[model samples]
Target: MRRLPPLNALKAFEAAARHQSFTAAAHELNVTQTAVSQLVKSLEERLGVALFERRGNQLSLSPRGMGYLPAVSDAFDRIAAATAILDETDARQITLGCGPTFAMRWLIPRLPDFQRAHPECEVRLSTTLAVRELQSQSPLPDGVDAAVRLYDPSKPEPGLMADPLFTADLFPVCAPGLAARLKTMADLARETLLEVRHAPGEWRDWLSAAGLGSMVPSSSLSFDFHAFALQAALDGAGVALARRPFVTDDLKAGRLIAPFALSLPKGGAWCLLYRPEAAGGSAFLKLRDWLIGAAMPPTA
Candidate 1:
């Protein structure tokens, strides 16, 4: 340690010099006025300098005190600035787990908005095919702060907080060129039906809702990923059964069109889930609120 007066004495001198009143400095530092006076006296005695001149209740910094104030204030400011830089370097990060399909088609597309709103927060996204894996891993793998998952509301996870993001709905969507030829549900049978192999029932449910339950397509193709099937539909290869939220942007952009008005609601919904303790911090709360706000309808 270098030779210097005690930190408390230095603080007392600085506060007293700035305010020019021992009572005011005491109020600001949450100490007794006598304590401020004594600390300043000790500092002046240790430095062999007259730091203040007192007359009755009035107090003024001496010539030496006036010169010392600027250096002391500058040092404190530099210390604070350095601490802030370290805080930002060690800033808290939140990891969100989501399904690969939803991550690509929904979450990823909207993430930039969240980033812009919270530049101080760092977000790491982890995508997986098994949504259940988000909860199944002991101690939560990959430091996942929270998860967006599809779950049956009737059988929600015990003791975990679940907030509905959006429900799933199935409807037939095809490229604009292909959609122009589809005037009715009957026309669906004439186009190649692109199916998501994992969710085979979606097409059947959508067909039943469209009044084409027993109708069989002339040709069909299947893909392991919904993204793949959707891409195929976008490319005019075939008509794909689109899920709500995932297909919302495409429909809005006119890249895909639902020729018929029928839509089938699925049994499960997409939900945001996290442990109770995980929701305590400001960073996580900001992300949670942003997600909820994004899910809501826009004002007129």
Candidate 2:
């Protein structure tokens, strides 16, 4: 119906042009540098014009690109603004893409507090098998509003705002009943250790980081999800490496106990991810700030 090229190609060109570097645009997009170049090239081909002139390491906007920038940027901005106004409602909704174990242990218990504080808003959660990027309703997806991810602050998502919460420390744990019998991390080689299937190399990575690289076990008893592994540990079947928030309740009820003082992979912190388009929305801002504070460590 219109003379414009594909939206994806246009978006890629816009980001690349704005930054003046495909590498920077690719980093912002969470995609490959080659992908950004391909998208921009596709856009140029569709338009039958060159958007950027590459000179060694630098990228210069062509005459056509300079003229097209304002219109393209303005169009996306207008759509974003319109969506915010249309989606605004008396009842606010915050949907989080949560992991299975986190949903079971940390999130559900604290939700009552969130409801009490923001009764005007309706808070919901989505527990997907594959993380949010692969989910139907991701952080930037329609109706999702926002999502929580293990993100690094120094690294930013180009079009999305990344608000980091607290960090999670990964440590090994087991049922309290087996605590007195199993004394050291080395003892696990003889016994069954509950392995999380998704993080297949986690055990190896943890052991290596802990300076126990030479102490590889025969094999671990694996489970598809953290919940299943936690359940297996609770049954006194084996020891499991528990991540904070995910294992908070288990430790609280004396259901599980940490076996070693050495912790590995200490920076898997949770973050709130949302498109910059929703940054100005009063509801989205409130939810984003609330969640970041909500996940603050109880130890603090």
Compare the candidates by TM-score and give the number of the best one.
2
lDDT of each: 0.81, 0.75
Model 1, TM vs. native: 0.65
Residue ranges of candidate 2 with Cα displaced over 4 Å:
1-74, 81-87, 129-142, 216-219, 266-268
| lDDT for position 3 in model 2 | 70
Tens-digit lDDT track for model 2 on 1-300?
Answer: 767688888778878888989999899888899999999998888888999999999898999999998889988876866475457672265566666677776778878887787778777777762464444444455556566656666767566777767566678888887776766667767777789777787777778877777885755789877888888889998888878777777787888988788777556467777766666566666677777777776674
Q: Lowest lDDT 10-mer window, candidate 1?
A: 82-91
Error of 2 at 23 (Å): 40
lDDT of 1 by residue, 153-263 (tens): 677565467778888777788999999998777988889999977778888887877777899998999987788999999999999987777787898899999887777
Tell me the deviation in Å of residue 51 in model 1.
67
Best by lDDT: 1
| Off by more than 4 A, model 1 | 1-91, 129-142
lDDT of 1 at 127: 77
